[model samples]
Target: MLFFLLLTIIICVLVMFYIKWVKVRSYWAERGVPFDPPNPFLGSLTFLMRKNPSLWMRDIYERHRSRYVGVWLFWRPALVVNTPELARNILVRDSGNFRNKFMTASTSDPIGSLNLLLTKDPAWTGIRKRVSLAFTSSKLKSVQAVAAAKSLDLVTRIHEEGVAEISLRTMFSDYTTDVFSAASLELDSNTTLTGEGAVRDITKEIMEFSLPRGLAWCAIFFWPDMAELFRVNFLPKKSTDFLRRILRAKFKAKSVELNKDPKTVLEILMQMMRKSQDQEKAYSEDCIMAQAAALLVGGYETTSSALTYITYLLAHSPRQQEKLYQELLVAEEKHGHHNMEGVIADCQYIDCVIKEALRMFPPMAWLDRVALHDYKVDDSLTIEAGTPVYVNGVGMQVDPEFYPDPYTFDPERFTAESIPYTYMPFGDGPRICIGKRYAMITLKNAIAAIILNFEVLPCPNSPKPAEAEIQKKGLFLMPGEDLKVKFISRK
Candidate 1:
C-alpha cells in the first residue's frame, strides 16, 4: 500500500510539471504572436541538436520577415525583432525600459558579474560614465599608437614565420592579444613574437568555446533562475583566479600614483578606484579587475576573428584585395608606413571592408535585453516585465531585402548608402560597445600593416566562403576551423 501511494504521488507531480510546461510554451501563441512550437526539453533550441544555434536563429529570422517573431528560450518567451523600425523603438526609443542585458550569472561568479556588460541600470550607468571619461579621443589616440606598434610587431613576426602555411586565425589572435595586453594592462605581452605568456594563455582559456561553457552561457542568458539553481559561472574559475592573481600581484608590487592624466586603461581604472570611495560611486577593486578582464576578452577573439574573415574575403575576392592594396600604398606613401594611425584613418576602402565583414558575421549574432518593466513595443504588441527580447543582428544584416545579393563579398554596398539600425557591428544606442573605438583602430592598423608587408593568398585547402567551419555552439559566432593562408612577402 505504501509503495502504491509513493508511485501515485510521483505520477501526480510529473503530470503537474507537464501541464505547467505546456502553458509556458503556449504563452506567445495566446498573445496573437507568430511562433515556432518550442521543444519539450530544450524549447526552441532543440534544433541546436542538429544545427548551429546561430544558423538556426538565422533560419528562424528568414522564416519570419514581419515585425517580430516569438521563440522560446527553454520555455521562456522571447520576441526577436525583425524590422529596423521596431528595433529602433526597442533599442533607442524605449531604451530606459530595456537597460539590463538578458544575462545573469553574477551569483555564481562575483568578479565576472561586476563588469559593465552584465550590470544593470544605475550601477551600469555610473561605471559607464566613469569609464567613458577614460576613453577620451586623445587617450584613444595614445592607444592607437600602441596598436600601430603591435601591428608592426605582427608584420615582423609573420614574415619571420617564412614559407610555412600559417593559420591566419591563430596568427591574428596573437596580434590582438599583444595589442590588448599593451593597451589595457600596460604590460608588453609579446604573444605575437614569442608565442607564449600568462596573459595570452589566460585570455585564450577564457575565450575558448567548449561544450560545457557554451551550455552554461546559454543557461545564464535563457533561464537565469535555472542557471542559478545549477550554479553556472560566466567564466571558468581557473581563468578568473589567474586574472585576479595577476592584478593582485601588480597592486602589491607598487603603490599606484594617481595621475592627473592617465595614459593606459589600467592607469585610468586605478585613478577611478582612488576616487571611488563615496558610497554612490562603486568602482570597487573587483570591478576594476573585471573591466580589465572584460576588455581583454572583448578585444582578443572578436578582432582576430574579424581580421581572419576579412583576410579570407580578400583572398577570394582578389580584385577588391588589389584595390585595397593600391589604396594602402597611396596612404603609406602619403603618411609614411610608420604613420599607421594616419594611414588607417585615410583608407576609406579599408573602413568599408571592415564594416561589410562585421555585417556578414557579427560577433555575438544577437543583442539580448530584458524588459525592465511592462513596456509597449507597438500599438499591436506589448510585452510584460522580464520578457526576453533579442535583435537578430545577423539576420538583419544578411537579409536580401536590405542588401541585394547579401551573400556576395561587396564592400561597395557599404560605400553607397547607409542603413540606419541595420549595420550594428558594435551595436546601437547608449549601451553600444565601449571598446568599439579601440577595436576599429586595432583592426585597421593590423590589416593595413599586414597588407603592406605581405600578400594574403588562399591556401590550397582553404574552405570556400559558404563552407567555412563555424562552431556549432559557442558564446561568440566565429569560424572554428584553421584558416590556412600563404603570406608572400612584399619586400
Candidate 2:
C-alpha cells in the first residue's frame, strides 16, 4: 500500500510538468506567428553548435523572411524583428515600451550590473544625459588630440615593421588602448609604443572571454534566471578589482589638482560627481567606477577590431584603396600635410569605405530590446509585455532586397539616399551608441595615419571574405583567427 502511494504521487508530478512544458512551447503558435520548434530543453538555442549567435539568427531571418518570427531563447520565447517596418515600430515608434535592453547581469555582480550599457532607465536616462555632455563636439575634438598622438606612434610602429606580415588586430588594439587611456582616463598608458601597461592588461582580460567567462556571459545575457541562480559574474574579480583600483587612484590624484579644465572624460565625470555632491546628493563610488568601466570597455576592442576590418577590406579591394588614396592625397594637398584632422574630415570616400565595412560586419550581430508593455506591432501581431525583441542587424543589413549585391564591397552605394531603418551600425533611436562620434574620429584617425604612411596589402595568411571566423560568444563580433596584413611603407 505504501509503495503504491509513492508511485501514484510520482506519476502526478510528471504529468503536471509535462502539461506546463507544452503550454510554454505553444506560446508563439497560439499568437498566429511563425516559429521554429524548440528543443525540449535548449529551446531555439539548440541550433547553436559552437556557432556565433548572430550568424545563426541571420540564417533564421533569411529562411522566414517574415516581418517578425518567433523563436525561443533557451526555455523563454522570443521574437526576432526582421522587416524594417517592424524594426522601426519596436525601436522608434514604441520605444518607450521597449526602452530597457533584454539582458541584465545578476544583482550580486555589482561591477557587471551597474554599467550604463545594461542599467535600465530612469537611472540610465540621467546617466546617459550626463555622459552625453562629455562627448560634445569640443570635448571630442580634445579627445581626438590623444588619438592623433597615438596614430603617430602607430605609424612609427608600422614603419619599424616595414613590409613584414603582422597581426593587425594586435597592432590596432595597442593603439586604441593607448588612446583610450590617455583620452578617457587622462593617463599615459604608453601601450602603443612600449606595449605594456595596467590599462592594456585590464582591457585584454575584459575582452578575452575564455570558455568559463563566455558561458558566464551567455547566462548573464541570455538566461538571466540561470545567471541569478548561479550568481554568475561576467567581469572577472581580478578585472573588476583592477578597474576599481585604477579609478580610485585617478580620482584621488585628480582631487588634489588645482586646475579643472575638464579636458578628458575622467575630468568631466569628476566634475559631475562634485556638482552632484554639492547639491546634497550622494553618488556612490561604485556607480562612478561603472561609468569608467563602460568607457574602457566601449573604447577598447570595438574600435580596434573595426579598424582591422576596414584595412582588410581596403587591402582586398585595391581599386577602392587607390581611389581612397587619391582622395586622401587631394585632401592633404588642399590642406597642408600637417593637418591630420583636415585630411580625415575631407576624405568622403574613406568615410564611405568605413560605412560599407561596418555594414558587412556590425560590431554586435543583433540589437536587443525588451517589451516593457504590450506593444501592438501591427494588425496581425501584438508582442506581449516582457517578450524579448531582437532586431536582426546582420540579416537586414545583408539582405539583397535592402542592398543590391550586398556581398560586394562598394562605397558608392552609400552616396545614394540613406536606407532607412536598415543601416544602423551604431544602432538606432535613443539608445544608439553615445560614443559614435568618438568611434568615428578614432577610426578615421587611425585609418588615415596608416594609409598615409603604409600601403596595406594582403598577406598569405589573410582570411578571405568567405573564410572570416566569428567568435562563438562575446559582446561584439570578434574574429577568431589572427588578422594578418603586410604593411608596405608608402613613405
Candidate 3:
C-alpha cells in the first residue's frame, strides 16, 4: 500500500510539470505570436551572457520589422517592440496601454517595492510631479553653477592627480555625484575636489544592490517568494538606512538655512509637503526621503556613464577633439570665461558629437515596460496581459538603416532635419528621464570644459572600447576594463 501511494505521488508531480511546460509553450503559440524559440528556462536571454542583449534586441527587431516578436524570460512571455512606430505607440503616444515597466521579482521585501521604478501605484505619479519641479529651467540654472564649479574642480584635480592616466568612470562619477548630491540632498560631496572617495563609497553603499539583491531580482521573474526568502533588494538595507539618515540630517540643515534664505529642491519639497493640507496630495517626510533616493539613483550613474563614454570617444578621435577644442576656445574667447550657456547653445558640432556618442553608447542599455492589459501593435500581434516588453534604446540609436555605417562614429546625423523619432538619448515619451535639462547641461559643461583644457589620449596600455567592451553582461553596457586615458593638459 505504501509503495502504491509513492507511485501515485510521482505521477502527480510529473503531470504538474507537464502542465506548466505546456502553458509556457502555448502562451504565444495560441496567439500566433512571431517569436524566437526560447531556451528551456532562460528564454531569449540564454544568449544574453555571450552578446550584448541590446544588440540582440535591436537585431531581432530590425530583422522582424513590422511584426512583434515574442521572446521568453525564463518561461514568461516577453515582447520585443520591433518597429519604431510601434515603439513610439507603446512608449509614448498610447503609453497608458503599457503603463508599467517589465522587470519581475518576488514581492516579499518591503524596501524592494519602495522604488518608483519597481512599484505600481498612483503615488508614483504624485511623486513624479513633485520631483519634476526640481529640474525646471530656472532650477537647472540654479544648479548650473554647482555642476560647472564642480567640473572646474574636476579639471583641476585631473591636472593635479597625475593627469598622466586615470579612469574616466571614476572621475565622471566624482563630478556628477558632487553635482547630484548638492542638488538633490543638499549635501556637498568633499570628493569633488580632493577625490576623498567617502561620499561615493556611501552612495555606493546605498545603491549597490548587492549579490543578495541581484539574486533577488533574478528570482523575481521566476518567483517572488524566492525574493522574500533571499531578502534580495536592489538597494541595500543599510544603504537605504544610511541615505535616510543623511537626507534627514541634510534636510534639517537645509530647513534651517531656508528659514534665512533662498529656495532649493529640498526646500521646495519641504515647503510643499508642509503647506499642503490635502491628504491625497500629501506625502510624509519618509516618502519625500524615498523620492530623493530615487532621484539620486536615476540621476547619478546615467550622467556619469554619459560623461565617461564621451571621454572614451574623444580620446579615440583626436581630430574631433581638436575641432571641439577650437570651438570651446572660440566660445570662451567671446564669452570671456568657460561659458556653459554660450558654448552649449552655439556649439552645434559639439552637440552632434555628444549625440553621436550617446548613439554609440546609451547610458541605459534598454528601456523596459509591461503591458497593463492585452494589446496588439497590429492585427498580427496580441500580447497577453502582464507580458514584458523591452525597448532596445541604444541598439535602435545605432541601427544602420536609421544611421548608415553605424559602426563608424559621425556627429553630423544630428545636424538639421532627420527622421523625427530617431534620437532618444533621454528616451521618448511621458516617462522620459526627469533631469533631461540638467543631464544635457551637465554633460555639455563637463565635456566642453575638459576639451577646452585637456587632451585625452589613448594610453599605452589602454584598450580600444569596441575591442574591450564591458563584458556587456550587466544591466548597463559598462566598460570591461577601466577606461584609462592619458590627459595631456592643454597650454
Best candidate (score: lDDT): 2
Q: Candidate 3 on 188-263: residue-level lDDT in tens?
A: 6767776554347656664353455445545653344456666566566666677677766765665433243334
The lDDT of each candidate is: 0.81, 0.82, 0.70
Q: Write the per-residue lDDT of candidate 2 for residues 266-332, one digit (tens) a residue.
A: 8767876676567665555666777888777866788888888888888888898888888998998
Residue pairs in candidate 2 whose N, alpha carbon or C atoms collide under 3 angstroms: none
Clashing pairs in 3: 105-220, 106-224, 470-479, 470-480
TM-score of 2: 0.95
Candidate 1 C-alpha lDDT tens digits along 61-132: 888767788888877788998888877877898888888889877465666577777877787898888777
**TM-score for each predicted model, relative to the true structure:** 0.96, 0.95, 0.90
Off by over 4 Å in 2: 1-9, 47-49, 256-261, 279-281
Candidate that beats the other on TM-score, 1 or 3, i.e. the better one? 1
- At residue 333, what lDDT does model 2 achieve? 91
Arranged by TM-score with the best first, the candidates are 1, 2, 3
Q: After superposition, which runs of candidate 3 have C-alpha atoms over 4 Å from their true positions? A: 47-52, 62-66, 104-112, 206-210, 219-231, 256-262, 272-281
Using TM-score as the yardstick, the better of models 2 and 3 is 2
